[model samples]
Target: MKLDKVSAGYHKKIVVRDVNFEVSPGEIIGIIGPNGGGKSTLLKSINGSLSLIGGSIFLDDLDVSGASAKEIAGCMSVVTTERVKPILMTCRDVVSAGRIPFTNGFGTLKEEDNARIDRAMELMKIKELSDIPYADVSDGQKQRTLIARAIAQDPKYLVMDEPTSYMDIRHRFELMELLKRLAKEGMTIVASLHELELALSYCDRLLLVYGDGHVQLKTPDEVLSEDLLKELFDLSGDMYRKVLRSVRGEKEEGSTSFFVNRACKSFPCHDVPESEFNCMFCYCPLYDTEDCGGDYFYNDRNIKNCKNCGFPHFRDNYPKVIKKLKEKMYGSGSQE
Candidate 1:
């Protein structure tokens, strides 16, 4: 998919500009930004749900800008955060809507439609909800149902806004993993995501839209670089240092399996519910540690048993770590 100079927002003024980017076939590109940063707007523009004032979107060789809604749906499917045209519908009916592109305006499903719907439900792991009333299900289930509907469309291109909106960490990771597997199986996907760490760790590429109208398109590795993240986020000094440290945690030596609980003011892994531990938590030193075992994490100062922690090691030389981090930030600068 190709996005060229795509600019869009309410009232026709561009909230973001000069957004030239491409999504390679069978690759996942994550669109991320601060709230009101035009992340969702960009996705809508590509899916043709929102008209763009200045640009063209192409899926393969087809120009999405000039295509009808049905034509666009023929090549692309979308799962939006907003509940559009939702009065009442069963999960079965919802999933079947994905087959609309091939059906008449009223959508008469064929036998293959039933099979595709089943496959979509199995993929989304929501087959049990097929007979359930979508309106009565929880948001997480509804989100999955809508996604299954999108999957049933079987379009080469899939677009979603905050696919993880109502899911837990495990479910979120599962959804992301599904996208990755689907990409490997030859589907091109672009989704707006709020979970920066997950997107950076999972997506083939990351597209950051800065509030100032500048855009950053880079691989996850390039986006992780100090200069890139600092510029993309307009972060500096302490905040920059903190975020870098968090990002840096991905490179650490411990298991990233951890969680941050609100009350203990600490993240204890031992108590994480099975439903909760769906692998959403990062086990790196950024969040917590797993070496000591049982709910003890790196955050909330759960380093009570780790000897390497800055205790006597940093009793007098504490500034060394921060200083070295700063030097690393400059690429070639030395503390001396």
Candidate 2:
């Protein structure tokens, strides 16, 4: 499937424009951007929810411009992160809904439907959750069930929006692995991911929407290496690495504890009465040299060397100090 000169929006106000992309028969594509950047809007456009204002989408040679809902359903299956309506039924029943596209209006199930249902469960490795109440399962299990349902539909293209939104890090990786496997097995997968690293590693192509009008569709390496992310996100300095870094796992090795300057603040140090927390920070050259007037951030790039400070190990609630410090740091202090 390919999106050609597609401009999608609501009413008359355009959200994202001039998006041209192609999905191979068995490739994984990732659409990434900050919030309100129209990732979801583009997904909806292909999922048959949002109408396109210009350009045409093609599934192989067929035009998507005038396709009916059912006809489109025959080509693509979708699993959105939006909370699916809870049907008062077992997990099996909910996963069975994927077969509805194959069913006639009256909803008759064939032997192929049962075979596909079994394949879906086996593919998701959710035979254990089959008898469990759909509502009773964990979010990860539910997500897998919905994915299984989509697989059961047996559509050529699979569209997912934040499929791992409810999953933990472990489950998120697991889900990505599963999607990659499926793509290798001949399913066209398009997803919008908040996880940059995972997307860069798994997706063959990238679509970055910078909102309003700017959009870039390129190979993952090209987009990630060309400062496109920095421009798209308006980031600079060390913070730029937060976006400019490759989505794949290629981070540089550094100390887990960032060096501190002489007077620079640490996590949350409260002025306690005599004794609360007690720990000696590793001293750096700046402290002995008196570069920072006994502050932690002295003359080092790592902000090392602090003046020796003491605490009595008193009892200050960690949460309260953390809350107040965060409030101070992110609050009106900077502007004032």
Candidate 3:
């Protein structure tokens, strides 16, 4: 798939302009940017869902703008964030809809089509939910079902927007791994991801879209080495370093266990010495504990108020905060 000088938006208004990129076969390309930065608009243009305001998109020499619906559906599959409310449909019924483009006029499913549907359900780990009502499942299950539906289409190119949105950590990892396996098997994937860590780890290349209609396609290493994230996201010093460390899989080396975001408007949220204040626990970790060992109280609405608490903000209390969190997550006996 290739985009040449493409510009797209809603109804004659251009959101992203002068975009030029090409996605090769068996590659995983990730689109990432701040919210409302035209990532979704670009995706729609690529999949021929939204019309291009300027330039052309091509799928192996065939212009997407002029391609028929069936022609486009045969080559590409899409999974958007839009929720589909299919009344009286089971999860398997929803997945079966993917075969429409390949089926006869009455949409009869053959044995081969049924086999592909079963394989898709298995890949997405949604076979257990196949007999359940589509509306009765949780959001994560619904997202998985939709993914399975897209997989059943058996298109060469897969396009997804925030595919991991409603999934938990384990499912998110599983989905990324599945995408990698698909890419190895010669499927091309283009996805917009809100999770920077996953994009950095899994994507073959990153497309950074700026709010000012500027776009850059680069490797994850180039993005990190050039410090583009700091400029793109306007991250604070501490947060930027933390992200860098996380991408590199490096641990904090020194005795510096605390961070202070002095640039914050709410600097000194608690009255403490500037030199000793620790902003590590900006929101207290012990807020959920009934006996929180901090100066807190319940409001008239039974809300736990920590307006005057400074226990977690002191530099020396870092170990205590970690211990408390461990005890809360595990049993007290598990705390070292």
Model 2 residue runs over 4 Å out of place are: 243-336
Off by over 4 Å in 1: 248-336
- All candidates' lDDT scores? 0.75, 0.73, 0.86
Q: Which of 2 and 3 is ahead in TM-score?
A: 3
lDDT, candidate 1, at 66: 85
Cα lDDT of model 3 by residue, 84-198, tens digit: 9999999999899888899999999999899999999999999999999999999999999999999999989999999999999789889999999999999999999988888
Tens-digit lDDT string for candidate 1 (1-336): 888887877687888888898788999998877778888888888899888889888988888878889789888999998975456778888898888778867778889988999999999999999877788888888888899999999989999998889997778878988999999999998998887777887799988888776677888888776357676666777887786666556433212333234354333432334434322332223122233233433434554323343312221333453354444557445434
- Itemize residue pairs with steric clashes in candidate 3: none
lDDT of 1: 0.75
TM-score-better candidate, 1 vs 2: 1
Per-candidate TM equals: 0.73, 0.71, 0.74
